[model samples]
Target chain A: MVLDGIAKTALLGVEMGMTLVLVTVGLTLIFGMMDVINFAHGSLYMLGAYFGLTVVSVTGNWWAALLIAPLLVGLLGGLIEYFSIRPLYGRNPLYHILLTFGFAIMLHGLVTEIWGGQVQNISTPALLDGSVDLVLFSYPLFRLFLLGVSIAVTAALWLAIRQSDFGIVMRASAHDSEMVNALGTDVKRVFTAVFVLGSVLAGLAGVLLGTSQAVDPGMAASIIIQAFAIVVIGGLGSYRGAVVGAFIVGMLNAFGPTFAPQFTDALLYLLMAAVLLVKPAGLFGNPEAT
Target chain B: MSVKDIVGRHFSAHAETDVLSGRVRLGLFVAGVVAVLFAPVAQMIHPFWMDLVTHMFIFALFALSLDFVFGYAGLLSFGHAAMFGAGGYAAALLIQNVTSSALLVLPAAVIIGAIVAAIIGWLSVSARGIYFAMLTLAFAQLFYTIAFNDIPAMLLGVDAVTNGDNGLVGITSLTLFGMDTGSLMSYYYLALVILAGMLALVTRLANSPFGRVLQAIRENEDRVAFIGYNVDRYKIVAFTISGAMAGLAGGLWVPFNSTATTSMLHWTTSGELIVMTLLGGMGTLWGPIAGAFLVVFLEDSLSAIGNWEIYLGIVYIVIVIFAPRGLAGIFQTVRSNPHPKVLLSRVRSALVTYREKVFS
Candidate 1:
């Protein structure tokens, strides 16, 4: 019985961690490539869920909504990059922070105005509605599918980033944009693309998690803080660090309630504080960059 | 002269004029304060307007406190409302459980705010730039979660003090030296006096040697550290001072509003304060106060329109892009250029300089 409880908790942790990974990886990538902290990232995620919900309701096809929502968000993100963010490149990071923060508020207002401030529900598709019998216990098939989808998406992203010529240029530019620019790479286009990719990932996470939870306008405000925490704990701009941090946070969040439900929220932040105290640059981040 | 030389000439001219204008501003400030002090006696202002002004003073103090760390010390704290809310909660709890004296509650609130700031500052000061900002934010959220979710009762086995989302109400007004503070007019005077005192105190601090070091750290941390100064210690001190000031603002808010809510500590509250600070003019102590008044007044008037957030966002974006120096910069520009032709040329030159700074 104890083993079964442990197994269940582990599963829950992985499920939560996958969702977090989807968000934080994108956040970390944007920070790495552009040095711009996208405060609107979570808002984009919220928008994705709202878009997915609207699309699914209108089309009656969940898969089509999933494909379309992220694309739409990515397009919006690209436009934002071109118009607002592109100008504040060489200025202090604070400019981008403020600009993004304003964008987040504006987006939230737009979302509320369009959808009205209500909890939105998205039903699971029929194919993934029931529970699946595991060796030890029955698990929600939808949740299992979510985990699989997250894994597949992450794997595909990893392969694309690791193997492609575009990936090499991206990695190089993140290190030294001036050098890449000198090498005839269009660094501006690269940055725009990176931002779009990040926004798309955020949108994807939104859709994936929106099905399980109720979506509201305020959803972005809360999740963004956690996503930021994940990015910080993992070490800013480090992919492996983000993944590791996500799992640690996800597991802690999953099991913290069992031991002390009230302290669960504090636990995540406390853990982050402790990590920062010990390793100021985060576990995998460069100290010099910090 | 070459453009660089022309810019250099203007810079020196502006500096000389600034010193002269400083005295003029100070005189004007005193006049403004005297006018406000006599506003209650004029009977021309409504009680509702008095209340709004009082609320503006409280937020002005809050924004000023934020400016200490953000504008002066060059630390962008995203969790500053934790200090503000902590002050409010501390004062409320004191009033509810311990004493009804404004004197006691207010001081306790300041101390509690300082203590909270110290703790958060100690943890976060080690990180620089965006990390420092995020760390402060996370810690603030931790406190917010504790207050919002009744975490203290479940974790520490204490009674829920923050009262969850409903917030703590029924805080009675205190009498000070035979005068009741519950009256709207009296509270307005009290808040105004306190704000004036705090503003003077902060202004003095900003002009001191320590303030100079704080500004120096903002400009270049490595250089300051290389000169044998403890950069981390200075940052912690600034954070603590700023937090205490914010706390004082929060403390004043509870008595003025007769309620304290956990929503005060929410991230959005911090964001709003940032907007106020940025809108007024960062790095300028008095700008935040004006910014606060402008924001609160606009919020009051435009709230009926029901799209204040969008307007505020557009305003912020515009300010960041066009007037990076903020509303205060426009005043400075106007002050330096008394003629339209010179002002136009100066504005054009300023834009060119800004573009070069940003794009090059």
Candidate 2:
């Protein structure tokens, strides 16, 4: 029975970790690239879920919703970047935080107006529904699929950000945008693209997690803190740190109740504080980033 | 001139002139308080409005505390509610267990707020800019969860400490010299006097040499450090002072609110504090007070209708983008450019030029 519990927890933890990995990567990417800490990243996730919900209803296909919702959210993100965030470039990053915060609040209200304040639930697809018989315990198939999707996405992001031609340009810009600009690359376009990509990841996470959780206007506010904590723990803007931090937080979230049920919600934040104290730059992050 | 320079010149001009018309702003503060108080007496103000203004008084203190740290030290804390909530919870616990006298409770609240803030500031002052903000946020959220889960109660093996989500209730009457402050008028007076004192105190601090050094740190930390100021120590002190003030605001809230909930410690409170601070204007002590009044008023009036936040958010964005100096700056501009035609033309040209920058 204990073995079954352990296996079940392991799977759930991995699933939760993957979902968080998706969210934090997007968050860290934006911060790394643009010096913009987007409080509205979670709002984009909420929008993604809401849009995915719509897509599912319209097409009667969860897979289609998965594919299209992020694109829609990404498009909206692109527009937001162009109109609202563009003007604030080269100014104080304080304005970026406030501007994104405004978007988060406004988007929450907009979602509430459109979808009502009630919690909405999305059912897993029939193919991924029900439990799979693993050796130790039967676990939900959709969660495994979520884990798979998360890995696929991570691999893609890693390749795109680390290996591709665009990746070199993106990395170079992040290192020294002034240099990149002098080299004839328009850093502005790079910023918008990166911001949109972050939005898409948020959307993807929203859709994946919405299946297992409640989808409401408050989703943005609730999850953003967790994402913030994850990135901070992993060391802000470090990709490897995000993945590692996500699992640490995910396992804690999944299994913390058994040991300290009272502080399950607080453990991640506590850990982030500890990390900030011991290693302010985060374990994987460069010291100067802090 | 290029549009960028034209727009920049306009904003920079305000920078030179808006050193806060000291007496005029203080005069406005006194006048604002009187209007708020007298309007209710004139039978023109609803009890709801009365409550809103009182709420505004508490938030004004909260906003002022934030401005003390942010405007002066340039430390953008995203989790100020940690202190406010600590002060509130401290007051609640004190009233329940120790004393009913708010005189005693409020002071204790300040001490507790200062202590908590000192620790937070000591830890967070290492990082600059947004990194500092995230640290404060993490610490605040830890406090939030502790309160939300009533970790103290669990540790003590009691029924509840913060009472979790239902909040610590039955904290309705605050006593002054063993007399129950049952009437709304007494509560109103209590909140008003404390708020005014804080306003005066913060204004005095802002004008002090300490305040100037904090501003110096805000402009350039390296320069301030090079000039022999212990930058981190100053930031921590400023943050602690801000926390103490926030605590008083929190303690004051329990009497009016009749309950202290975990939301008091939530990041949204911190976010709203920033919004309120920015709306009034930063770098000026009175700006936050003005911001609090306007925002609290708008919030209350619009509570009946859903989606008011969207509009407020839009307004905040516009204010952040075009009117960085906020309401205080606008007031300064109107005062300086008394001629409506000149003011209108200046605004029109600035807007047109700014639009070109945004589009181009």
lDDT of 1 at B287: 79
TM-score of each: 0.92, 0.94
Candidate 1 on B1-360: residue-level lDDT in tens? 699999999778755533114754686488467747665654465677888888898999999999888988899999988999999998888888887677887888899899999999988897888878888888898889889887766667776778888889988775577677888877787788788888778777876678878988999999999999999999999999999998999999998888999889998899989989998888787778888988898888876888677777888887877787788877777877779999889778867865664354
lDDT per residue for candidate 2 within B1-360, as digits (tens), equals: 899999999778745544455566678677767855663583455555566677888998899999999988999999899999999999888888888788899999899999999999999998988889999999999999999988989889999889999888888668998788766667767777788788778867876778878888999999989989899999999999999999999998986787899999999999999999999998787788889988898787776787778888999888887888899888878888899999989789878866775676
| Model 1 steric clash pairs | none
Model 2 has a DockQ score of 0.71
Off by over 4 Å in 1: A286-290, B1-24, B27-31, B34-45, B154-156, B338-360
lDDT of 2 at A262: 83
Instruction: Mark the regions of model 2 whose C-alpha exceeds 4 Å error after superposition.
Output: A287-290, B1-23, B29-33, B36-45
